[model samples]
Target: MSKRVNRVAEQMKKELGDIIFQKVKDPRIGFVTVTDVEVTGDLQNATIFISVLGDDSDKEASLKGLNTAKGFIRAEIGKRIRLRVTPEIEFAFDESIAYGSRIESLLTQVNNESKE
Candidate 1:
C-alpha cells in the first residue's frame, strides 16, 4: 500500500470507530472496538476489522448490525473525509487479541510447571 492508501485507511479507521460508538444507537451493537482497516488499492472497498467483547451470539449480532449500518457508515465517512468516492465498508471479526491472550496463558502455565 502506498502512503496515500495508508493515510486514508487510518483516517477511516478512526472516523468509523467514532461514528459507530457515538452515532449508531442499535441495541445489537454492543461493545465494539475497531481494530484496523484495510483499503483496496483503488480505494473502492474497505474491510473494517473489529473486536466484540462478548460471546459468540454477541459477536454475530454486532456483525449483523454493522453490516446493516454500512450504508450509514459510508455516508458518514464521505462527509468526514474528502474522498472522491467513499469506499464500501465490510465488517470482519478480529481474533488476534484473543489469540494473544491464549498464548500468554500457555506461556505462564509452562513457566509455572518449570518452577514446580
Candidate 2:
C-alpha cells in the first residue's frame, strides 16, 4: 500500500511539473518548479509542493491561479494517468530550499565572524 502511494506521488510529481510548465499559461504563474508531492494514503488528496522563483506576491498569485485551475488540472491528470479516482490537488509552497539557503548564509556569516 505504501509503495503504491509512493509511486503515485512520484508520478504526480512528474505529471504536475509537465502540466504546470506546458498547460498552465496564466501570467500569475511565473517561473515555478514542482519540487515534491505528497499523496494521502487513501489516494483521495494530493498536496504538491512547489518552488516559485519570484517575490512573495508572485508566489501568492501563482498559488491562487493554481487553485482556480484545480478542476482543469485534475481532469487533465485523469485523462493522462488512467486513475480510477484522481486525487484532489493542493498547491503548497516549498520552503525547504529557501530555508537551506538562509542557513548556509548564516553559517558563512558565522565563519567570517570567527575569522575576524
Candidate 3:
C-alpha cells in the first residue's frame, strides 16, 4: 500500500472504531475492536480486521452482525470521511490476539516446567 493509502486506512480504522462503538446498536457486536484496515490500491474495497472479546460463539455472531451491517457502516464512513469513493467494507475475524495468548500460555508452561 502507498503511504497515502496507509494513512487513510489508519484514519478510517480509528473513525470506524469510534463509529461502531458509538453508533452501532447491535447487541451481537459486543466489545468489537478494529484491529486493522487494508484498503485496495484503487480504494474500491477495504478489508477490516476486528477482534471481539468473547468466546467462539460471540465472535461468530459479531462477525455475522457486522457483515449484515456492512452497507450501513460504509454509508457512515462515507458521511464521516471526505473520500471520493467510500470503499466497500468487509469484516474479518482477527485471531492474532488469540494466537498471542496461546503463545503466552505455552511460554508460561515451559517456564514452569523448567522451574521444577
Candidate 4:
C-alpha cells in the first residue's frame, strides 16, 4: 500500500470508530474498539479489525450487527472522508485481547501451582 493510502486508512479508522460509537444505535455493538484498518492496494476494500468488550456471544453479536450495518457505515465513511472511492467495509473480530487473557490466565494458574 502507498503511504497516502496508509495515512487515509488510519484517519478513517479513527473517524469511523467515533462515528460508530456516537451514531450507531446498535445495542449489540458494545464497547467496540477499532484496532486496525487495512485498505487494499486498489483502495476498493478495507478490512476493519475491532475488539468488543464481553464474552464470545457478545463479540459474535457485535460482529453480526456491524456486518448488517455495513452499507450505512460505508455511507457514513464516504460522508466523513472525501475520497474518490469509499472502500467496501469488512468487519473482523480482533481476538488478540482474548488470546492475551488466555495466556495471562495460564500464567497465573502455573504460578499458583508452583506456589502450592
Candidate 5:
C-alpha cells in the first residue's frame, strides 16, 4: 500500500471506531474494538477487523449489527473524511489476539512440563 492508502486506512480505523462506539446504537455491538482496517489500493473497499469480548454468538451478532448499520457508518465516514468516493466497508473478527493467547498458553504449558 502506498502512503496515501495507508493514511486512508488509518483514518478510517479511527473514524470507524469512533462512529461505532459513539454513533451506532446497536445492542448487539457491545464491547467491540476496531483492531485494524485494510483498504484496497484504489480505496474502493475496506475490511475492518474487530475484536469482541464474548463468545462466538456475540461475535456473530456484533458482525451482523455492523453489517446492518453499514449504511450509517459509511455515511458518517463520508461526513468525517473528505473522499472522492467513500470506500465500502466490511466487518471481520480479528483473531490475532486470541491466536497469540493460545500460543502463549501452549508455551507456558510446555515450559511447566520441561521444568518438571
Candidate 6:
C-alpha cells in the first residue's frame, strides 16, 4: 500500500472506532474495539477488523449490528473525510486477540506443569 492509502486506513480505524462508540447507539454493539482496517489499492473498499469483548453470541451480535449499520457508517465517513467516493465498508471479526489469549493460557499451563 502507498503512504496515502496507509494513512487513510489508519485514519479510518480511528474514526470508525469513535463513530461506533459515540454515534452508533445499538445495544448489540457492546464493548467493541476497532482492531485494524484494510483498504483496497484504489480506495474503493475497506475491511474493518473489530474485536468484541464477550462470548461468541455477543461477538456475532456486534458483527451483525455493524453490518446492518454499514451504510450509515460509510456516510459518516464520507462526511468526515474528503473522498471522491467513500470506500465500501465491511465489518469482520478479528480473532487475533482471542488467539493471543489462548497462547498465553497455554504458556501458563506449560509453566505450571514444569513447576509441578
Top-TM-score structure, candidate number: 6
lDDT of 6 by residue, 6-103 (tens): 99999999899889999998888889999999999999999999999999999999888888889899999999889898999988888999999999
Write model 1 residue lDDT over 43-66, tens digit each, in one string.
999999999999999999999999
Tell me how far the alpha carbon of residue 77 in candidate 6 is from the true structure, in angstroms, after superposition.
0.4
Candidate 5: global Cα-lDDT?
A: 0.95
Question: Candidates' lDDT values, in order?
Answer: 0.95, 0.91, 0.91, 0.90, 0.95, 0.93
Estimate candidate 4's alpha-carbon lDDT, on a 0 to 1 scale. Answer: 0.90
Local accuracy of candidate 5 as per-residue lDDT tens digits, 1-116: 89999999999999988999999998988799999999999999999999999999999999999999999999999999999999999888899999999999999999999999
- The TM-score of candidate 6 is 0.98
The C-alpha stretches of model 1 lying farther than 4 A from their native spots are: none
Q: Look at candidate 5 and tell me the lDDT of residue 96.
A: 100
Residue range with the least summed lDDT across 10 consecutive positions in model 6: 62-71
Q: Is candidate 1 or candidate 4 better by lDDT?
A: 1
TM-score of each: 0.97, 0.96, 0.96, 0.90, 0.97, 0.98
lDDT of 1 at 25: 84
- The alpha-carbon RMSD values of the candidates against the true structure, listed in the order shown, are 0.7, 1.0, 0.8, 1.4, 0.7, 0.6
- What candidate 4 gets wrong by more than 4 Å, as runs, is none
Give the CA lDDT, 0 to 100, for residue 1 in model 4: 75
lDDT of 3: 0.91
lDDT accuracy of residue 84 in candidate 5: 100
Pick the winner on TM-score between candidates 1 and 6. 6
**On lDDT, who's better, 5 or 6?**
5
Distance from true location, Cα of 43 in model 6, Å: 0.1
